[model samples]
Target: MGCCNAVRLNKCDEYPTQYRTDFIRTGYRPLPFSFKECIKSAFYANNETGNIWTHFIPFLFMVHRAYNVINQFEDLTDPINFGYYVHSIGVTYVLIASTIAHTFCSHSELCFRKCYSVDRAAIIMQGCSVQLVFELYICPPSCYVAEGMGRNSHVILTLYCVLSTIMFCSSVHPRLGRFQRFLATLPFGIGSIMINFSCAVRYLYSSNAIESTCFGTTKGDHVLFYFHLTSACLAIFFYVTKLPERWYPEKFDIVGSSHQIFHIFVAISLYFQNRLIEHVTAEAKFKIETGELLREPLASACSQTVGIFLLTFITVHSVVALYYWKVQPTIQICKPPEKKE
Candidate 1:
């Protein structure tokens, strides 16, 4: 949205009325745009310009962090280190999927649904990945559902996928109320927060609770965990309220939108979470170097994480495809808004 001249922008009347709902824009990208055009449009000014870059920039930044992790850390094959690798993948995929969806969503009505369908699936997987990381690396053992609670992780992951599938269907089936969609996605967030809260309770309240790594060595206080939770809740509030812009739509069509603010907070949240893991990993690595800790590789957790991603990935998109095939015929073109004159 930095550009003063926008060659690809078109009036809102030129696109579906859905573009007008809860969103005000000076112009939107033309419909049925090519993928190549979508990529090229990221450089130009349009309604979704900020949305595309907000997540994409963080995606690139995380890629750089991944590179740093590979070079600076030893015992790279250790499962404790490897589990965080899995979390990084989830963080990376979520941003990339959001960027892709934002970039290509204006292509057509079908395109919009398909793009966001993929985005929702990616988000569900991210939640599952977060759970896996918490179970294996972060949570103190004193927490009720801490590490070694493999069964709890499985049940929570299954519930997330089931509710997420309903949410996926809601994205494709236009008749589903917004409240229905909200309800479907609520379980995943609630499940994740419950696990985190258990850790928080153990850390904050229990006199015996110790901040420790998976290697069984106690560490310092859990500052990063608290920061992660704070940033995450801030991001969620922005997402739910659609703030500032909802109060003043005309002033925020491009740069200062709520979605953009949400993306920034999400990035910060991820940074805090990453640093928390890195701290634990650093301590574990030191012990390993001194011949005090052995790398177990926890192959089971790795396998389970991969399974959750594949199952959710296939289930969500499959329902999306079926719904589109059945409903495409009934979908109608946008009628231009009538002129006042």
Candidate 2:
């Protein structure tokens, strides 16, 4: 009772391993908090407060933005604008799903796993939805001339499915922890870059799309590749290093934590992502109306959405369900960490 008397306990020091998200984070709610308490804690200034609000605020913003997107077309099912709606729905769903996962993760292992699985699955769909629209309207001139419904397009789609599968499996594996999950994100990151590459190149460099109105109405529109790259880099740094909290866990426990920083940058990245979608959508619409765009638009965009739904459903639910059936009941709590002399 000597040194321990002055120190509050870390839940990870005693709880089952799956409940732990970060070794440096010390403000976890007790392992069996009820759903009501977990929801209530979102209001309290706990470690997850920032995580919850970052995604939740973005979710609300995107919901508003999606409503405006709906008004862009008279028919809800117009194929030309329909992919935009799919993208909007996917983004908003992931944001809200992230909010829910962070909010209720303390409820129980089952709830935690289920919520996070849903969040991860939503993210997969979001990536697919984004790349689908980009392929339809945001890709450059060469995309039409070289890969117009060609082999590269199918290759990209297959690559996404494969990488997403790796990410999903590593994410839910009982033996894999944060660091392994971080490694898993390498593949996830590759898939994400593939999703954004067509649009990102326009922001990063001169392109036929950029010279024309379909790309933009102004020169040097954003140079947003640097902006998003910085955000993603910062996010990865915090996620891997665990930052200032890694050095002084208690000082940053309730605030100034690395996860909070990570969440802030993630929200920023997604907000700008949606903005780019709106920007490119407007430009594409203008071109379509004026007959500037050649090559039929959205030949496979809707079909890809269906394939994405199937892939995500298979990989995501299988990972979660297999965890429940195989991993959950078998894992055991570990002995608390020992104090240094």
Candidate 3:
């Protein structure tokens, strides 16, 4: 079994060269193609060790945060408040998927690709969940046209999911070059920007359209929102550029690599998002307690929207898996022959 200790250290060229990427410059060791071996690697150390722990540690934090968020809510019946709980679940899913993808990706190319799919799906789900929470809180039924906003939110969620699915499929398509894969993933970031812009517009419009205190009262909220936006952008930039590592490759293989930096930025962004969700939850609860806001029953429209998203997610994964399996034989033939140990 490969490990990261000095005795077991493996340079970039020492591993199966087929798995090498510009980002995974060096200090990587190939793991035996076994689930048990992969799990053991997590403790021994390896190139993927850092990547795994970065997300895994944060995954633990997210679990704790999710629990706290759920406990804070007095009523799980209100959809608006319940949205935060759902958001927590989505975030936790993303973190855990990321951890698993990174930890065991070295086990085999096939495992890596499948895990990548899960990671991408989880990320898209997280983004959509965040958008849903924002739309619900920023343009609550008290301030906006309840029926119209509900429908709009549903439509937006469906469209975003479709776009995300397309992006994920294109990114992993065996035919795509490196540049093309990068381009394929760009839509996820761009879509997020578009959603934020729309939410900002809704906030402004809602403020002008009604005399409700439910929207945009906190200066800190705006600050955290922009901070998160910046963090997200930075994370994407580091990921795309493969910076620092690109400047001086192997030196960062074990630490301070661009991928590690990207993971840190992502964690920071999620922290800000959690804070924002907490702020919104507090506001909603206060309103409910003060009799300024009435607790609305969970909207059937919201349930339908979630169901549509789930269906789309499943369909997309199924199609991608089918395509992979269909072409996998050809892919194996084209790959370089494995060397005998």
Candidate 4:
């Protein structure tokens, strides 16, 4: 039923076959697809349901975080707090858009592909957007054109933004087919390289200063930092090579799958990155607002943030993998034919 209708009936229950037929006749149609597509479609729906809700529900948690951060600004001593507001809004918008797109994507193939592309773009955009807090902390907007030492952070941030743009664009047009996914790999590969370079520059130029600024700093922070770097490398590698699982084929479909592992690792990397960024930013914020830097006595809050994200990421993906395993048929692995040997 549409607007102005007296009764809005659920089509799947009320008309079933006719509902689908009417939808197609009205130009809202799914893909002209094979059995393989049917399997993919069902699995996509299942995965979308879980993935959207898992990430979407966290918006409440984010709102709480935002509230706390805003409250932290009650003191006039705090540096400009405007940046975080925009950051929070951007994060919330991405989550909301992602959830809505995924939920309704199954309406049609055109819808599905467009929504999936938007979904992927949201992932990339969120990663890039979150980095801004760090940029703002290390160097305020005024320092963007600053000369000498203060300029390093600004330069690195520009590079980071450029790479993120590339990633978002690649997802927007991941080519036309299997071969097209390869094109998508290029931007992520480049982004990975640029990020590593940025990390190195950050550490080499500003390590002690940054360390003195953040709270609850520890050796593990460095460990997790490298872990994030390694995962980024692995994400790029897997995107390009499609290894292990590709080598073994359908054997790893349900659990112990490469893509699933990649997703989990990506989430883990983001967790670490967020912690590190928060630390770095807090340090920078102290420096800009006052001549001195102060560290939070307890980084328990940051740790909790990381922990919740990891738990949610793993639990959601595990459920999705299980659902796909039980509902999907065993796919026969196919390799591109070798030259007529």
Candidate 5:
């Protein structure tokens, strides 16, 4: 009931319709238009409080993990270690973007749309990063260049990045309806399924695998990989369905919402992924020490160039999306309509 830094709190019903999603229709609080006030609200109780903390806390853990990984493997020349470092960076960005989006989305309708675009871009970037790490692990530089499968995998990943960027950009188009926005995210979901399938196939044919430390060879590793896949699937299900909260909206307003559950599952899935990465990295190190395998070179120049291009494209796409959604008044939805009879 009291004010947070002289800014009064609002209830679910007070939220603008444009700001309300189907699952989060209530328990909303108004944020001050000022940047400082909106940021200060992160400390106070509100509808987005759970969402903000969920990713914010994880972002801190990610930072710590990144530091540990870099310190442990100071030699970034090792392709596997470098891949892990890049993955950590990607995960950190995802968490921070999610936190910022949830924290300030209530500031205004334009802010909400802009932040939503940033969150989507972060998701796409994280997905690409995951694929990059997995590819580096499963197919080192020599194998990637020598084998047709590796070449095909790289091409597929590049296409996924391009498609995801396009999808996110399209989702923000004013002409695209709400249903289109929902459909825009479907490609990434499908891409995830395809990626998992590829990993499974590679595991099944481990005898012919180029990498000695292929994941899913051991029964435990297989189970862990499947667990990670299940966690990811569950997160996606909750995100799309907006369950629990969708069934009982106001009851779970400040917490226990579907988005919060999705974030938790995401973290769980990443935990499993980390475990798998650690196991494979250890195995790779043991193999190298035993003279069973040699450390392959890092990604080739062409591969690195492609990666840089994709990163640049994603950056440009996010900038254009923000500009169109926030800075361009003509494209914004808040324009006053002409007088009607």
Candidate 6:
């Protein structure tokens, strides 16, 4: 039996390489350039401190979250499953795009503005993909005993992510300019509003069990709403007004920049938003399965909810900052080729 077990382990290890190679060939590479260059360019010249850290930090959080998912659900699923692996690859794509955008963006005039836009688009995709993967595990009724709640909640969350993705893609388009950015803001705004409104309606109609839970109350709902609102507003204002930094130009190059602030808030808000969903999903699952009161009070849940949000926010934001520090923009004014001097 011991010899048989040893042989089986060796065979299992060998099987994965074939699959891993397939993924390498077909899936997205995590970063396009050398790791050293990616880090170096992040702080070079753009003052893109927030942009670089935003994605970098989230990549770490995703690593942690992926681990938690594995530990928590070990029996029901395997961490090495294809769907799970592919989802992670998507995150790698986002990080690569973000790193590349930060690294080479300041290399040329064309690369500068384009990198910012590409980073924006990559973030949108990252946000959507995160929600999608979470849904795959939460949506099915396998874990939940209740029927209507699981299906309805899944549909609503999925729809919200889809709209958010569309809005992000449209709003971040390079050619759409300021006007398009404004239009793109609408979807996120609407989605945010709807989330609060639905929670309110759920409280009004649902029985005491759900209503009493953290997921339903207005006060509890505000935790997510306020942060998301602040984040989205900052991004919109920065893009539209082109504030302090834009007005001051060279003076704000290294710090005190509006774009940097916007990036920080956007990352923070995305973190908060995901936590809000995770809180509710975890609750909904418990409710459907046990049909008992939550282990913690609504208020306590709200606080935990907020903490998770900020934790994710800080980590991702740190990466954004470091990336920018390494890749500061090269500031040199052009003088019409200097007449061959």
Among all windows of 10 consecutive residues in model 1, the one with the lowest summed lDDT is 209-218
Give a tens-digit lDDT track for model 1, residues 1-341: 54436455766666655554355556577766777778878888766888899999999999899879868866576555665677788889989999998998766666777777778777776776677666665563434334464546566666666667556656455566566546545754775575576567655654543333234234353677778888988988887788877889657777778888888998998887777767766776676668665545344545655666667667656665766677445655444456787
Off by over 4 Å in 4: 1-104, 138-179, 205-224, 237-244, 251-256, 288-290, 293-341
Candidate 5 lDDT at 88 equals: 70
Per candidate, the number of residue pairs that clash is 1, 0, 0, 0, 1, 25
lDDT of each: 0.68, 0.65, 0.67, 0.44, 0.65, 0.45
lDDT ranking, high to low: 1, 3, 5, 2, 6, 4
TM-score of 4: 0.52
Model 6 C-alpha lDDT per residue in residues 54-170, reported as the tens digit of each score: 667776776676567546643333221323433444455566677567555434333443454455545544544444433232222222223344346434544554445444444
The parts of candidate 3 lying over 4 Å away from their true place are 1-10, 13-18, 139-153, 200-216, 291-309, 325-341
Which one wins by lDDT: 3 or 5?
3
Clashing pairs in 2: none
| Per-prediction TM-score | 0.82, 0.79, 0.82, 0.52, 0.82, 0.49
1-341, model 4: which lDDT tens digit per residue?
22214222222223223112111112111323333433343233222334445445655556676677667655433333433443465466556656655456545444444455455445544544444444334322222222343345434544444444334433333234344445456656554544455444444444334434333234555565677778766765654565555677544433344444455455556555655555554544556457455434222323222333334334333433443346333423222223454
User: Which digits, one per residue and each the tens of the lDDT, describe model 5 over residues 171-280?
Assistant: 65555667564656686677686557666665555555555434325566667677888999999898888888778857777778888988988887876776676666
TM-score of candidate 1 to 2 decimals:
0.82
RMSD of 6: 17.4
- Say what the RMSD of model 3 is: 4.0
**Which window of ten consecutive residues has the lowest lDDT sum in model 5?**
330-339
